[model samples]
Structure formats: C-alpha cells, structure tokens
Target: MPVPSAPGGAAGPATPPAPHITRRGLALAGLATAQFMVVLDSSIVNVALPSIRRGLDLTPAQLSWVVDGYLVAFAGLLLLGGRLADVFGRRAVLLGGLTAFAAASALCALAPNGPVLVGARIAQGAAGAVMAPAALSIVMTLFPDGPDRARALGVWGGVSGAGGIAGVLLGGVLSQTLGWPWIFVINVPVALAVGAVVLVSVRPFPAAGGSFDIAGAVTVTLAMAGLALGVVMGSDAGWTAPVTPAALVLGLAALAAFVALERRAARPLVPLRVLARPRLAVANTIMLLLGATAAGLFYFLPQYQQNVLGMSPLTTSLTQLPIALTITAGGLLAPRVAAVLGVRLALTTALAWLAVGLAWLARADPHARFLDGLLGPFLLIGAGLGTAFVYVTTLAVAGSAPGETGLVSGLVNTARQMGGAVGLAALVALATATGTPAGTGTPAGHQPNLTAAFLGAAALAATALLLSLTSALHHPAPTAASPLLPGQRTST
Candidate 1:
C-alpha cells in the first residue's frame, strides 16, 4: 500500500511536533485580565471620590486632577506605549506595564495628600498605556484566523464593558467595608497573579525592529497634556485668560508639529497613512463622541443617586447594577447583531438609542423617581454604549497593515480619553453657570447648578448620534478581494 499522506498532506517526512501547550488560550486569558484591570480603574475611584476628597482635603479643582491626571497620562502616552510594544516584545512590555501599574497602585494607596495621589494616578495611567496595546496585540497574534479572532475580540469587549460597572460596585463595597485605599491596594495582588500567569504561558512573538520615535512621543505627550490642562483650567478661568489661550495655542502647535514629524519619520509613532484612511477616521471620531457621553454619564450618575435621590454609597452602587448588567448583555449580543445587520446599521441603531436615553435623562428633576425616571434611560445608555463600542473598534482596526494594529488601537483609545477630558471640562463649566441647588440654607440663588450639565450631556449624546448616522450613511470604498479561504467568508 502507498504510504499514507501525513496530516496536512505533507509529501516529505513529517517535521518534529511543536510544544503541546496552547499558547492562544494562555494569551487570551492574560489579555482579558489586563483589559479588565485597565477598564476597572476608570470607574473604581468614582465611588471613593467623596472619601478621597475629604481625606486628602482636595479642592474641586484638585479633585478633578485625581481623575484627569490618570486620564491625561494614559491618553497621552498610549501611542508611544503601542509603538514600544511593537518595537519590543509584547510579552516583555506587558510584564513591565503590570509591574509599573502595581507599583503605582501601591503608591496611590499610600499617598499622603492630594498631589501624591494625583502623581500616583498619572503613573497608573502611564502603566495602563503600556499594557493595553500589548494585551490587544497578543489577542491578534494568538487568533490569526478571522472567526476565532472575532470571538476573542467579543470576549474582550464584554470584559471591558462589564468592568466599568463592576468597578463602581466593587469600589463601593471595598470603600464602605475596608476603606478607599483598599480600592488601589486590591490591584496589587491581582496584577501580581496575572503577571505570573503571563510570564509562564504567553509565547513571545517576533518584535518589529525599529528605532523608537522619542521626539515624536514627547511632542504628542506634551500636546495632549497641554490640551487637557488647558481645558481643565479653562473651566475655572475664562477661556480668554492669557494662560488658557497660551496653553491651548502651545498644545495645538505641538500637535501640528507631531503630525509633521509623523509624516517625515521613517518609523513614525503613528503612520500618516493609517490616519488618512476614511473608515478609521470616521470610526475614531465616533469613538471620541461615544467616550465623551459614557464618561459624562459615569461622572454624573452618582451625583444623581447620592445628591438628588438621597442614596447612600452602597445603595448608589446597587442602583447602578442595572446599567452594568445591561451593558454586559449588550456586549455579548453586539457581535451577533453586527453580523446580522452589518456594522453601519448596528452602530447607527446603537447611537440612536443612546440619544434617546440621554434625552430622557435630561428631563430628570429633583422630584424624579428612580424606577420611573432613571432605570430605563440607564439601561438604554448601557446597551447602546456596548453595541457602539463593538462597531467602533471593529471599524477602527479593520484591514490595518501588519504591525500597525497596536498603533491604530492606541489612537482610537487616545481619542476616547481625550474626548472624556474635554467633555467633562465643558460640562463642569456649564454646570457652574447654571441654576443653584433647590432649598439651600441661604436662599434660592444658592441652589446648586445641575440643569446645564445634564443638558450638556444630552447634547454630547446627540452629537454622537449624528456622527454615527453620518458614518453609517457614508459608503465604504471598494476593496481588493479578501484572501480568506473559501467557506470562511460567511457572516457570523
């Protein structure tokens, strides 16, 4: 009898078998853990904010820094971090980032004052920047096949969506029972465990050989920092103030210079060609708007629960559970919806839902009941946000060139972070200018300002809806035939 063909129809003698360990499974676990950690940090401190403010004697401006510091650093350095992951080994970058994040979390827990806490938060953001790209990139490498990759990405999305809501609930429980410091302290153990798993299980991929774009990184970081600082300060000081304008001008100039550098550099921090892609540009814009709305909602929801509804920290956390649960469900369903409806239609529907939710929220009054007024809107926002994220992420990275995925993902996230910073700043300013709190001890004039802020959030959601619609209506350019194997092109 003729010799039976070896597996995969090899004519020559079969090569020696590779290792038995399943690297893809290990990588997916590590990446999901990293993403969960990053997303958790975004909302973990929110429930603890009042405690932190009192403990640290933080002014409103300084309190904003606690959040802004982390956001600015994370957003500013993300592009650089992604580039480093590509140039270095992703595994090494991930390990280093986790270490840095753990160290920073310890510092935050031990912080003596507002400045120290702010500094630690900034360090945490920088650490997040380093890890996030590597985590996503590992997923890409682990699941090179399209269907498997989509499933992995869906799981990742679900983790991130669920993590945001989980953070608030977890923070409330930890802060009420343990203390605010426990929130930060809790991360250390988790990081250590995940780090060990990654070190043992993740197989390193070949690094992209290239020189680090230090100058480009510095300029972009400076640009983001300056712009964020300018916005934060402009909220307090009039935008026409010399310092505010100066910071804004300087930030714009630095950003323009970074763009020029990117176009010229052989190994650009962010390739100009990638940004020039229409689909990526539109998706990123939508991501920015969606991020703004999401961040604003998170920022204000607690205010509604505690200030208006007279809920305690624990009660407030429980109240948010509906939104969180819905978001998790929406994330799991988003991929299926996209496969059935196409990316554009799904995203448009999601955005429309978000707009409706925000509009309902804008109608909230001091007399509004939780079940009647708040629950439906919160659920709508959460579901819409989950679906929108799925579409935006898919479009942002679709058909990206080899080794550029990290950069693309980082840019998308950066836009998101920056949008949150800008949106919050604008909302704060509007709130400051609006009506006072009802039944103040002094007089009607002393009432708290909340109407404008909620209105601003509604406007943000409306803007996001418009952007999503525009994206859906825009026709995608024709592309070359896909190289996917026959029978693999069927929609999920």
Candidate 2:
C-alpha cells in the first residue's frame, strides 16, 4: 500500500516503514501484563485462604475449593476459549476477558459466603482461560518465527511464572496489612489499568474464522467440571461415597462422549492428530506432573510456616523472595541449556532438581528452622520451575501447524490447570489423613503432615524424571536436514 524500498533498502529514501515493530512490542507488553495477572490469581488466594476461612466460617475443605474451583473452570473451557479467540478476534476476546475477570474479582471481594467466593473464582478462571491463549496467540500473530518471537515468549513465560511465586508473597502482605478482601480488590484496578493500556496499544487480530464447535465445547466443559468436582469431593466425601463415584463416572462418560464427538465434528475443537503426537504427549504429561507438584508444595508450605512456625503473613511472604528471583534466573538460562543438551535431557535435569528440592523439604523435623530446612528446597524448586516451564512449553508447540498454535497453547495450559486441581485435591486429602488438614493441629503433629505431602510431591517429580529418561531412548536421529525445534538457537 505504500512506496517500495529504494536500492539500499531505505523506504523510498524518505519515508520509513510504519512503526509496526514498535507497535508489536507494545502489544506484547500489554499481553504479558494480562498473563501475569491471570497466573497470579491461581496462587494469590492461597495465603489469603486462612483469612477468608476465619471471616466466612469456611471449613478446610471449602478453602481448598476456592483455588481448585478456579482451576476446574479454566482447564475445562480453555480449548473452547482458544477457538473463540480465533473466531471473535484476539483483542476483542482479551478485553472482554479482562472485563469479566475484573468484575469477578469484585464479586469475590464482596461475597459474604464461601459459596459465592468460590463461584466468583470460577468466573475469574473461565475469563482467564479466554484471556491467556488469546494473549499468547496475539504474540504468535505479531512476532514472526524468529528471534523476536522467541524473546517475546521468553519474557512472557518468565513473567507468567514469576506471578505464581510472587502471589504467595504478595498475598501475605495484602492479607496481613489491608485485610483478605484487598487481595481480590487489588485485582480490579490492575485489570482495568491493563485493559486500558491494551485498548490503546494493541490492534485486533483477524479472527481465525470458522464455525464454532458447540457440541465439543459443551461436552468437554462439562467433563472437566465434573472431573474437578469428583476429585475434590472424592477426598472430602470418601472414595466410597455415592456422590463421588457418580461424579467420577459422569465425568469420564462425558469425556468419552467429547472424544467421540471430536472425531466426527466438521470443525473439531481439538484435532486428534495433534493429541496423538508422541513428543507432545510426553511433554504435556511432564507438564501435568510439574504443575501438580508445584501446586501441592505451594498449598502446604504457607500453612506450615504460618500455623506451625507462627510466622506472620508478611514474614512468610518474604521467605519466598528467593524462589521468585531464582525462577527468573532459571528462565533466562533455559534456552541456552536446551540448545546445548536437547529438550529431553534438559527437562530431565530440571525434574531431577525439583525432586531433590522436594526430598530435602520432606526431611523436615518437627522443630526445624526456615533457613536450615526450607530455603534450599525453595531455591531448587524455583530453578526447576523456571527452566521446565520454558522448555516444556516450547516442546508443546514446536511442530504445530500455523493455525493450530492457539489450540496447542490452550491444551498445554489446560494440562497445568488440571494437574494443579487434581494434585491439590489429592494432597489436601493426604494432609487431612496424615494429621488435621495441613497441620491445623498440635505443633508436634504439624511437621509430619507437611512432610507426607512434600514427599508425595517429590515422588511425582521423580515419576516425571523417569518418563523423561524413557523418552530419551526414542529420540529421532538428527541429520543435516533435520529441523531445529521452533525458535531454538541450535539444532541439538
């Protein structure tokens, strides 16, 4: 539409190209901010759970629902949400999602009962599911497959993860100083501010126009909701409870139906071919384990520090600064490690690091000190989380077809959310069974309960490590013609 470049690649030797690149960079900043806020919600409420429980008269199990409920809706709707972004336009979807999320946060803040708070959390999660993939898809749309895209993703991934750890620390300060309601109230201003920036900076992406898959969306959403409910209630209501079995059966049946529908749908929500890829399958499984273990550890760690150790919320939050910093460092180094060691080897090493950290924490004694007992494990976990998230996400979308990027992003995130929901449910049950639900008991009894949960998380990491080793045996032979994984600096 404009003049061609002159001989020296100057734009007609007078007018420069439109400031498209700068616009893209600005857009990336807006998207990354939205992503950071979405991820922060997943953990920010954790430290506030005790305050909410006291204010609203919530049981320990009900408190778990506040976090898990968000996860359930997010995981369930992610695929459909991604598709909708393609249909509705990325900027439109993201703005809409941010609006909904902000409103939900207000709802959560104003709720006087546990049920209302949990419901609001679910609304926030669903909106986040829409926002996250749409935001990332915008990244892919704006940045070409090169160093630019890679760098943007690196910043995106790092900020997304740092939000999770930072939430624990921030939650403590807000709950301690401003009261628990401030945690949710804080989201309103941030979300609105980010939305305003995005509106002004980011242009709308053309919709990946298609007929919506109504049946697929409905069934899968129902399946994930049922599964999350079953998992949560399975522990609380006992495995043999009639409702638990019914929910489990209903969830599985709906899942089967969703699969059957997808196989025949004219425009499927998730293509079977994508799911069948061997490398993607393994990578997602590893992500699931990593997500689950991390969620479990975060869930219990604060309870131990506050309940057993009698630490104030501010002090407890400060303890996690080391984790946040190390995760940032780990993210910076992940690309280099992947270039040198290959994806499988690098991921395995990261998993091993996580396992070591968890095992170290598992050895805690009844009267342990934080510096001697917890700091080392937190460092290891942060490093592992930082590196694993980068590489695993790269692997998940490595070979995707052009239009399928949003779908894969949604699937990858769904794995993490589902893993967190299920893992937290299981660990919550374990802690209850071990002793009085995350050490809400005598000081002497607290350490053992937390130790059991930490060991369980360690075991999950080890399992992922074992899977990574098995996958290494099946690596394809590298050749001169082989393609490097997407955006990797090398062919390793």
Flag regions of model 1 displaced more than 4 Å: 1-28, 143-155, 203-208, 240-242, 339-341, 397-409, 435-448, 471-473, 478-492
The global Cα lDDT (0 to 1) of model 2 is: 0.73
For candidate 2, write residues 232-348 as lDDT tens digits: 677677879998889888889989999999999887877788878776688778878877887788777777777767777788788877777787788778877887788767877
Clash totals in order: 4, 0
Error of 1 at 207 (Å): 4.8
**Model 1 lDDT, full chain set:** 0.70
The residue-level lDDT of candidate 1 at 50 comes to 63
Clashes of 2: 0
Poorest lDDT segment (10 consecutive residues) of candidate 2: 1-10
Query: Could you say which candidate leads in TM-score?
Result: 2
